[model samples]
Target: MSNYRNHFMSHIKTTIGELLEKLEQHNWRHSVYVNEPEDTSIHTVCFVIDTDSAELENDVFTPSIAAQNGLREFLPVHDLQGVREYLANVGVSGTPEAELFAIMHYFKWDTYPSERELAAYQ
Candidate 1:
């Protein structure tokens, strides 16, 4: 990975860490899968979260108010099939140029909203 890619990944990891911490505190569990770009592909970051249950069908993971606001920039997947399709279409490997574009498309970090913005999102 280039220095630029490494830096971006580090930033994303840090943001993810903070989000995970908040989610865990609120009874939300998550899993993240990252596919590093290869010679011709792009990086793919897949984030999946669930509630207290471990079972795929049983777990009812709804984004908390804070999480929802914080993740406003991401393309939220509502169905398992959609998530699977996204992963399948965007394989884990890509060239540096492709990866750069991938960074702009996937695994985006989000921002927290103020009280008024929060109310609007709700």
Candidate 2:
């Protein structure tokens, strides 16, 4: 079982590395979020790759329409499709979201409610 797990993780890492390279080639900025739910009932890891880019438009900037929609059209269709299928087969799940709120909710940061109160305490 350990050998199988090692092989599975290795394959996933290799696939993600290849996909990141492809994204870089197209000059797209990307973020990868991985969540392993604390609930034992949920047996899969949630892997999301969010990508974005800006386009030059009449001296203004606009988001890439293709990327906004999804990677299907922005990237070669087969590239993303193959990755999705591979993940599904391995009992892993992959998804996309417009924002990173899902994973951000789990993060804790050291912040003060007001700068004045923090300065006084210091």
Candidate 3:
């Protein structure tokens, strides 16, 4: 693995560990799956919600405050304020580039948000 890969994995493990510990501290037991991206071309950082699980499902509907902070660091842009709107305007979808951006962003990698998603907002 490249140094970046190792560093990123370390960050991921640390984050997950902290999250799991918080759950345990609250006397909450949970199951977690740390899945790696399957396709070689797609480096998706994903969290799949088990639709039946209350916590995970609740998480999905909520916007991620962390997403903006992490996204700003990874993307070339100096700001995150307009990203979701930008993505919407740009018409970003499941295209490979969009997929990569989504996946990488989840992993805290800063691929720029799709311009199409942004343009449509105006």
Who wins the lDDT comparison? Answer: 3
Model 2 per-residue lDDT tens digits across residues 1-122: 01122322211212233443333332123333233223211222222222333342353432233234322212232333444444445444333320111112222222212323223222
**Per-residue accuracy of model 1 over 18-117 as CA lDDT, tens digit each:** 3322322321123332332132123333333332332322223433422433332233322222323333354532233432333333443232222342
State, as a TM-score between 0 and 1, how close model 2 is to the true structure.
Answer: 0.20
Residue 35 error, candidate 1, Å? 21
**Deviation in Å, model 1, residue 74 alpha carbon:** 1.3
Local error of candidate 3 at residue 62 (angstroms): 19
Measured against the true structure, the TM-scores of the candidates, in listed sequence, are 0.22, 0.20, 0.25
Which structure is stronger by TM-score: 1 or 3? 3
User: By summed lDDT, which 10 consecutive residues of candidate 3 come out lowest?
Assistant: 1-10
Model 2 residue 71 CA deviation in Å: 14
* Weakest lDDT window of 10 consecutive positions for candidate 1: 2-11
- Residue-level error in angstroms, candidate 3, position 2: 31
Q: Residues 1-122, candidate 3, lDDT per residue (tens digit)?
A: 11222321212222222322232222112222233322313332322112233232244632233232231122211122233334545665434454434544544544554455324333
Q: lDDT: which is higher, 1 or 3?
A: 3
Root-mean-square deviation of candidate 2:
16.2
In candidate 2, position 15 carries an lDDT of 28
**lDDT (Cα, 0-100) at 73 in candidate 1:** 21
